[model samples]
Target: MDLRLAVYHAAREGKLRLLQKLLGGRSAAERGEATSGAGAGVGPPLLIAARHGHRAVVDYLLEQCGARVGEGGPVSFDGETIEGAPPLWAASAAGHLPVVRTLLEHGACVNQTTRTNSTPLRAACFDGHLDVVRYLVGECGADLEVANRHGHTCLMIACYKGHADIARYLLARGADVGRRSLKGNTALHDCAESGSLEILKLLLDAQARMEKDGYGMTPLLAASVTGHTNIVEYLVEGALQQEEDEEEDEPAAEGKKDPSTAGLSSSSSSGQPQVYCTREAAVEALELLGATFVDKKRDLLGALKHWRRAMALRHQGGHDLAKPEPQQLVLAYDYSREVSSMEELDSLVTDPDEMRMQALLIRERILGPSHPDTSYYIRYRGAVYADSGNFERCINLWKYALEMQQGNLEPLSPMTASSFLSFAELFSYVLQDRSKGTLATQLGFSDLMGVLGKGVREVERALLHRKDPIADSVQFTKALAIILHLVFLLEKVECSPEQEHLKRQTIYRLLKCNPRGKNGFTPLHMAVDKETTTVGRYPVGKFPSLHVVNLLLECGADPDSRDYDNNTPLHVAARNNCPLVMSALMEAGAHMDATNAFKQTAYELLDEKFLPKAMMQPFNYVTLQCLAARALDRHKIPYKGFIPEELEAFIELH
Candidate 1:
């Protein structure tokens, strides 16, 4: 082994004497060679010991071997380690307070950063090392506002890792709550993505703005997309409360009028209701407030009052009089779509409908009904209606939009593709809920099949018309996978020979399309791409359609195919905590022992600390245990109670 490797091993293993012997009597040139391995370079012995929390080895390396405490060096031979990090950074990253103190006492810079501009304070915060973070900010005078290469502040990293205590300490120490990442996400956004409800509340109380990120996603929408139900509820409640508070303050600022002298008639001077001009506005207000009563009964009466006031403004032409510019109208429409998606997840229907209607009206007026932009808004409105359980209306709206673009747009246009996808998704939903008197039930199976077949042919024609259709395009592959997945779902129902032929053609197209798309994800990966949530397990039998996975498997997709990160389908399933997918992959003999590029087994990657919050879940703990049991069984190892008793009972019972 290289001398640096030998020294690194000795220090990491806490063999101080061995580390000293390796360094003693070595020439300066040899010492440099030992510290500098091939490529980046293995970190010095002191850094190795500090990173492993070997206090004695670190002390001996510094005090006895005369290792320079502040000396910066290249990365380790593994090529995965950080380059140009000082000993203090390693110690801080590992949460070795003693080693950190020793290095600092020996004149190490407290704020020294890595080549990525990641400071020791950020490392400590990222690891949830509260004591070390406090020491760095409070005693060592580390800059709280410093951001890493990704522009993540200590507070943001703390929230991102779900370290509530560290976040609190950092906030108390004056860490800026408004500091944003390179993506323009604040600490609150990090908390939302991480499902750190406690940290989210802390940031909210500290006045973190509920602003949109570069992707036009609010913190609430981010939480919803990640399926953090608790965070979603909290954010919604907070928004309602802020609106209430603002309403209350408005009267105070305007000075209260004498209610006794005010007109008490049902009609205003203009012969309209005092609160609203149109009956539609009144009905909408009641519906919006009434929808909340199902789950948010506590806010019902207050919300009703607030709605009346809002409607009064709208009735007085609040929307038309202060019409936003065309650009602002588009932005408003985008925000409405995000809110509509969140409401769909929450099963709340009223607010999204009202928002969508407002956006659609604005777009129709500004862009004209036949404009492609108006058609896009129409498609969005259809989605909102579908989410609201009005499948027939959703289908009609989408069909109208498609009709408007039939001659004006190219078959291969992105807008046309999106419309087809919308129809496919809505039709699939209708099929799934056929017993619920959905639109598909009204239309016979043959009629639905006709619509689906037409869509398939249009998509196929578009794909074939493209020059060099086989050329790799991530967007095309994703679109093709979605269409095929829908076709696979339709395959479960009985079909005529023509419909069956179309289905087979769709499947052939998907199979022929390049599976290796963006981030090296195969079509199978895109089919089940929902992020895992910390909230709870998805209800039984509600997993996204398994037909996609089944079709891919039957078509000879390698179960152990690795992505760019070398994560196989099993690894993806494990990280996403999709137990149903996990079962299917395991049944198909997926490689349970397959490891990622980081040498993490599928079981080991089960949404612990490293993955984004959206990918962490309490249910993943159970999945981890189950996967562990499966691994042991595969190896013919005995069940020796290595797992928790409850888990063992679950495995045995199942």
Candidate 2:
């Protein structure tokens, strides 16, 4: 066995004599030399012993052999292993309290983090190792407030893993109850997500705030989404109690206040309202928990009123109050409108656009003009405009929104990617109808081209400057594909040198990335597939485009690139009865007789019967067959199954 494995096994099996022989027999200098010479596999023998609860081996390794206790253990990176770790973390994770105590007594770093930034306290808390957790914090002085790589504290992990006792102990030891993760999720949110009613109660008792996360998900909403009925019920009860307390306190405070003084006091001067679950969120939670509403309309109207008040209170303290986060507000609006529409309640005010606009303005004021939230709301409003048949307003809104987004967000950020997709969709819609002359007349060609040119430049910059272009190559390729299609549509115009350069660069980037789309087809395959279709026309099936195929070929796309089915671009074009594409491929020197997994060649797969009736008028199957026959002849290949007479008969029938 390898020296590392031998030492590991000796420790794991509690062979104290063998472990001693491996290291304890050596002097301090010799032991150090032995450990130093051991490869990455030989992690600190102390960690191995501690992990398997070999207390005797751990003591021998640390006390006699003088093994370092603070060294980190093995970490896997891209299928290769690198060993290192603080032995206390491994011991605490394994719930070996004796090993943990022994290591700490020997001066192991109690709060030392592993490769993943996880401390011994976090490991113990995650595993619900009560004794180990207690010893780490109580005896070894482990930091309870430290968070791991994902910003999860001991309390959050305990709640997430449903370790109620561990969570209680952490709270008792003064863990921060209101601490949030990078995504703003609290311990209560974890408890709700885990469906642990006991942990949920513990967190609530510890005064865990019920604020929304960055995604506008509160604990109640999280519980509802996960279908946790009991937890949802508990949260709802807590919310109701909070509301009742506020109501009871309201009248007494009102009675004590002077009417003359009240006139001068602004709303901001009043005490901040306690953060609780919004009524809309609570009702939605209850409904999702399988609770039926008897008076649905009344409940919805009441929820709407409650949300409006919450929104007002959120912005009451000027800049002191929390900024407007629209997800929850949008949810409220959606629910209100949905319920009203379902019950046909005409009496309810149904102006969602105005409400959304108000929310957007408040978010911009609070979160600033270039915040991702602001951009998101802008995109949402632009989509609303698009849906209302106001294309001009929609395009203008997206243009300004993209400009704002470009200022703050990186080009490859999800926010910018989403905006790009939406912009591309709207642009495609306009191009689809440009040949009809209505869109061209409404927006002058120069203005339209200018917008398109700007979009192309943005996409190019994003693709070129992306941190990991290959990982995000699919999205980049799709964006470039859209740009190329737009460029094709503008072929009639006298293009600027810059526009022509962008078109060429865009095609080159698309080919260089060689992005395999979700369907497993490369950009080359997609280009050919798109070209098979008629220009300015939606094909009922596969319509061939010679223009796109020629463009991709010029950009050095593999003419014979295969898709998921191992069908080359020629096979696809031939299977779809695309005569023009077949000709283009043959001219590009595509393998004429390349066979797919099914052993069917491109020429053998052609079937005129599969052609749509509308397409049969313009397409000549006999001509396509003749082209295939000529290519076969040039290659000195004979027709296998069909005789000369049969070929003539088939051509005559076509």
Candidate 3:
């Protein structure tokens, strides 16, 4: 080992005598020899000692053995350094306070950097080593202003990790509290991410910036995601109070004697304070600031009220807001509406607000609810409410918009069926309130089944009975397939064996019509569509038959059936990496070599990236077989079959 590395090792391992002996034996100037793991045979021993936390060894080499400190560069045990952090940086990161102190004391440069362009202080701070940081910054006077490769300072790193004391000490010692990272994140950003109220208040007291990040996120926005409501309030309150103080200072300044005017014969200082900043402007600025904080949080209700009042002031001052950005309009609606309940038929109606008692009042005040021009408004509002814990309400409103096929469609009309399907799909997914069991029960699955069944029979009868075969009848057939899928999903939950059998038969019958049959599914696709039931309580399994996919293929349901995307059933199965489906598709004559629009083969689309070795066992077999088959079939090569003699004999006898 190099002399410096040996000294570093002795120091890290607490080998006081060894460190002392090495230091004393070597002349001070002689010990400063720089050795690299590069051109030379071996690296300096001090690098090893420091890398292993041997503080005593490090002290002996530097102080007694006379080892010299040099500039840090790429030096890795495993050969993967980014910029140039050496052994000392490693020691600091591992919380070897003693080693850190000894290095700094013995002239290991405080601001020394490595291949990654990271300083020792940055390494300590990033790893949450407060003691090492204190020793470097307080005792040795390391530059607290130095930033890492990513432009993050010790204070920013400290705040990000919720190290309140380190942040306080750094701030007291003149660290830039408002310094932003490469991404424009300051100490406030770090503190907000930590969700630590104490750290956030410390940064705020130091006047750390509350400005937006590169993506326009403020401290408050970070706090919201972490669910730190208190931290969010603290930052907002500080900004608000600061604005108030500025308001008071403006008036006092106006009352002070004016030097320029006093020199002129006709000029005199005002005895009373003249109004420079108005009460309205002060209120408005504070309101707008509050609105900004809330808006960053996407707290729709709070923001809407604040912005509305602020906008009122703007209008009074004869100002107009730039056309609200699409995103802002989205936020405005998010704060404004509520959903109530979902109808059995899937039609959604908005929850009436008592705040607007009359229709005309509602139309004038609130953006006309459910109006075509304002659909997105209601949709966004409903979405925000869903995100804010009012799930039932969100579900109701979403259904209303998605299901409006006819203005006055009856319970079982074609329009009603269309509306029901739209509503069913939306509610089945979105509302999902377990508390609505009573309402779901009242709606009755049997009624839905009857309507769906009637529709299915109507289509089948038309297909079998009609001579001209009106092209429009395809709509009824598609509706019936959708209904069968819904029924198939429901049967898995509470339906009897007979109902299940009926559902299976309906699926089979629907498959015979084969709406998108050529791409890989018939009515039997429900066996695989993993959507939830109407009540949303149970997870309906993919298809019932282990052999259902095989049966579909045998019965002429296309193995390559795709929806609008032209993706074969084999494609969906492969993308999900479902081995059974893949096998069935291959056995059923799906072209293994087919590529999607992305020009990716079914095998290539399987995401094996970063998967654990153990969990990958299944995918391994499936991918290999699929790819092997594709290669063989492409060249007209036949694959040999594998079957037991007993199975072969049984098949021959049958």
Candidate 4:
């Protein structure tokens, strides 16, 4: 390693003696010259030492070498890199109190923030470092109201993290309680959603109003959505008590309250219904809480309990809260209906299967299919079914989720790519399972073909707007490899004449899209390369696969198509030592004498160990025309104007 990087590493590891040994009493200018230029990769020496809580090393660098205290450099937290984080911000975020104190004592800016505008105090509050928070705020003059780019404040993070003492300190310091984030969520809403009942109480006592967020959710509903039963009950009970106190204090000049409005109050002054107020909010909270119990907790009995309470509340007044109805019955949900009456809801407990179906329906209805949790729970349920040996149900539910993601997410979205990759892994695992005749069902052609068609559609969508770059190459390549794996798996299925035609039509559509992966590899290059297996968590599919290669050629993949390296698929086949694939490509009219950029023909590129196998081919597939093209190119004969444009281009391939 470079001496500069070596010194930087020693400083980061907190070895003060080693750092001193390396510097050897050099002058400040010499030391600075030794550890210059952002420490190469690990930020400056002082930044890394402070980030890792190396107070001794930090002092040595600051007092001895005069390392800049306020200098900003790259720092990473929780696998995500936060660029340009100062020493104080790194020390504070890492919860190193002494290191933070040392940096602060050395004249570090207290209000210094990261590239994201997250402050030292905010970072300290995030991890519940009360001492660092106190030092920064009470002594160093750290600004409490300095929010990050997303407008999230220190009080909001403190409350959400359930740090009661820190939250109290911030409140005592007059951190604004009603401050809303970019998403319109206040500290009380965050506290409720994170299940911090104590913080919720603190915010409520601070007069935090019941307000709607960007999602139109109040604190009570936020509690319900996150399955915090204690917070829900508290918010509901408080709202009810406040409503009674208001009724007692109101003037009689307003006239007697209508007898019909029992559980709910009249509309507010804005003419908008005050549904977020009084019992109306409580009713909605219970309904959403029931859905949370069903999907998130997977507790059917608990869901039933919440639903019963909501139904009881609904029936207490002349006006019943309307439950939103699905416009059309979904076959995926087994056409389950939302139970409006208590009798219908009560009957669900007798049949567990029906109860589970009701849970899926209720969650989808309440949260909508667009929410990530809705689809995540769906996939989770399918995986549970797969573990219990119910493979058919698992496949059906996964198919539904893939369809939903395609409809909702952007084309070439990572979520959709993940779904496609999951299908590839599942199909590969099932096919390789020896007990398929007894333990698992037979693989079907449509099952693999359907996902391939969707994968092709994603590619086509990305291609439709040519002005925009294709989805980043990683996503594009993974999708391409998965589609090839699906094609490989389809051959394992016994298809009828009609099924075969449908399969070919899908393959044709994919070929016409002409999508390219990394290295500008066409489908043919990917089919012959061995790296295709590492696309997923599992070893998804084998490559240098003759079956997939044949399928590509049969579907009109060009045999002589050149990649970015100008190596045809036959060259890739040769590098993999795949004689059978090379023979097949040669049979499909691939030129054997076509030299790549390295000027090596496929036959010359063959591995020495594979020579015994290469000798078994019927004959060398190189032709007189190919040799003549190669000779003209090698000798630099000027044949461009004399030959046809197509033939002239062909000669350049050598």
Candidate with top TM-score is: 4
Q: Could you say which candidate leads in lDDT?
A: 4
lDDT (Cα, tens digit) per residue for candidate 1, span 239-341 = 2333333355555444443222122222333532232112222223233333233223434344334334434433331122222344333332333321212
Poorest 10 consecutive residues by lDDT, candidate 1: 532-541
lDDT tens string, model 3, 270-334?
54322212333323333333333332444435544443444443333222322222222222233
Ranking by lDDT: 4, 2, 1, 3
User: Between prediction 3 and prediction 4, which has the larger TM-score?
Assistant: 4
Q: Looking at model 3, which ten-residue stretch has the lowest summed lDDT?
A: 339-348
Which tens-of-lDDT digit does each residue in 571-649 have in candidate 4? 8888888888888899998888788888888877777875664463534676777788878977888897898999987
Between candidates 1 and 3, the TM-score winner? 1
C-alpha RMSD values across all candidates = 19.1, 15.1, 16.9, 4.5
Better of 2 and 3 by lDDT: 2
lDDT of each: 0.61, 0.62, 0.52, 0.80
Question: Taking the candidates one at a time, how many backbone clashes does each contain?
Answer: 0, 12, 51, 0
How well does model 3 score by local distance difference test? Answer: 0.52
